[model samples]
Target: MSYRRKHTAQTFITNALALLFIFLFIYAGLSKLIGMSVFKDQLSQVPLTTQAAPFLAWAIPTVEVLVVVLLLWPSLRRWGFFSFLGLMLVFTGYLIYTLYFSPYTPCSCGGVISGLSWRSHILFNLFFIGLAVLAILLVPSKSLEKQQ
Candidate 1:
């Protein structure tokens, strides 16, 4: 393939991934905010987060919304991908810890995602993590675009 075609393909993939992340964050953030009481209760049930449940209940959705804002801005899209990857890694790591190490596992996820089993949630996060990595790789730097 030609340079132009390859660049176009990469751009398309990156944009698609951004859109997906935006949707995921928006949905999750809104879901948690809307059901604040339930979400907080769920978080409180998690032994590790029981003490910080209240603060995290608010902070998590706020960060998700912030990430959505980053993803929407063209200039900040690369940072958005990095942010998404970092969040996914943290979430997946927590899930792994809860699944294998912790004696108690509680689902604090919002929306339909709350229904997913722990193993399924890990897989879901892994899939998004992989996409986040691909988006980071495919997103062209502003300098590169300027030179082109």
Candidate 2:
């Protein structure tokens, strides 16, 4: 309950969440790059995405990596936080679209979450989305933290 201890805890949580997002984004982006053929094939199977497969194939991983870079710098870390938050929301939306509207939901080509069932995958996305939201809420703005 000491002020110092509380401050340490807050700092730890902030850094931990930043690291978490960094790891996830890097892993995902690498997975796509490493398994390009498989990822492209998976994207092709999704309804209404066949034509955009080429564009998305390059774009998703690129943005993920960009977010990782953003997270590494203190000055731009807030942008990283917001980027991941938006990405997670978009991901969840795609997952829902596949589950409810598409005829079939294809599995991810790589990453730990690839093994999860569709329902579990949804939960997984939601879990990370919640984490992102929590991190954003808990971490002080860079200027504010510096001034503290």
Residue-pair clashes, model 2: 0
Number of the top lDDT candidate: 1
Candidate 2 regions with alpha-carbon error over 4 angstroms: 1-4
Range of the 10 consecutive residues with the lowest summed lDDT in candidate 1: 102-111
lDDT of 2 by residue, 1-148 (tens): 9967877897788789899999999999999999888888888889867788888888999999999998888677778888999998998888888889988788754778798887888888899888888878876786777787
What are the root-mean-square deviations of the candidates from the true structure over C-alphas? 1.3, 1.7
Which stretches of model 1 miss by more than 4 angstroms? none
lDDT of 1 by residue, 1-148 (tens): 9989999999889989999999999998999999999889877877777899999999999999999999999899999999999999988998998788877787778879999999999999999999999999899989888998
User: Model 1 clash pairs?
Assistant: none
What are the clash counts of all predictions, listed in order? 0, 0
